[model samples]
Target: MAKPITKIDEPILTEKEKQDQSLKEVLQDLSQNADGIKETMQLLQELHESGILGAINNLVEAKEQVAKIAVGQMLRPPVTNAINNAMAAGGLLTEMNPETTKKLMGGLSKGLQKAEEGLQANKKVSVFDLVKLMRDPDVNRVIKFSIDLLKGLGEGLKD
Candidate 1:
């Protein structure tokens, strides 16, 4: 308290001291994460044994060639077409009501089940049987749905 402090002196570390300090910190971290390091080493050993590590190394070494080949493959007509079709299908799916799609899928499953049962029965359908089937609530409902779907499709096509 007799003299007022005018300046502070900070300890300046040499390059060698800085490197040594860094090594000490790294060693401390390694010791703390010994189990994780061991697990990683084991995984690396397994990958090396399986030739995957070598493959990965090669891939890294020839990254430009690999990228070119990948891009070439992706740019192929069939691949591009598939990607485009998938995008279109995704767009169409988004526009469809989930509830309606779910209902349609459920109905389709039930219809398939009935068709399978009919196949097992091996029954022949006559004109009278067709008339009788047309009167069936399930058949009628499906016919109505099909007609409505066609009408909507036609309307969309007009646009």
Candidate 2:
């Protein structure tokens, strides 16, 4: 006689297991949220303080490569006209303006570095510190400034 697979006797998860599972779930949710909010550029300072910006730097470099290459890429999906329009609208202004572009990229890179750092730091930081950092007005202002500066540089490049 063999026990049925549907409801074999299985011990309940212990408290430690439950705690660990809950933490994992919460961390997953935070990671998803962080990815969605990476554009906001709010966590730069903390992330730079930590050392995980190197990983983000790697991702940025990889994206640059993809943008530059079309090796064996399927062309079944033609580039949409709308995307073409957007690219024209955002054509390289840094073409003859390397200095401005360099400064812009430098600042932009630092801001993103912080965000990557934040994601790494989040694993070790408490919920309270996270909330405080998220809600801080200073952080909000800096992100806003970054957004404006980037937008302005992009707009300048259009001519």
TM-scores for every predicted model:
0.82, 0.28
Model 1 agreement with the true structure over 33-143: per-residue lDDT tens digits:
999999999999999999999999999999999999999999999999999999999999999999999998998899899999999999999999999989999899989
Best by lDDT: 1
The prediction achieving the highest TM-score against the true structure is 1
How far is 137's C-alpha from truth in model 1 (Å)? 2.2
lDDT of 2 by residue, 90-132 (tens): 7756254878778768877997998899798776767898678
Q: Which pairs in model 1 have colliding backbones?
A: none
What's the CA RMSD for each of the models? 2.4, 29.4
Clashes of each: 0, 2
Worst 10 residues of 2 by lDDT: 70-79
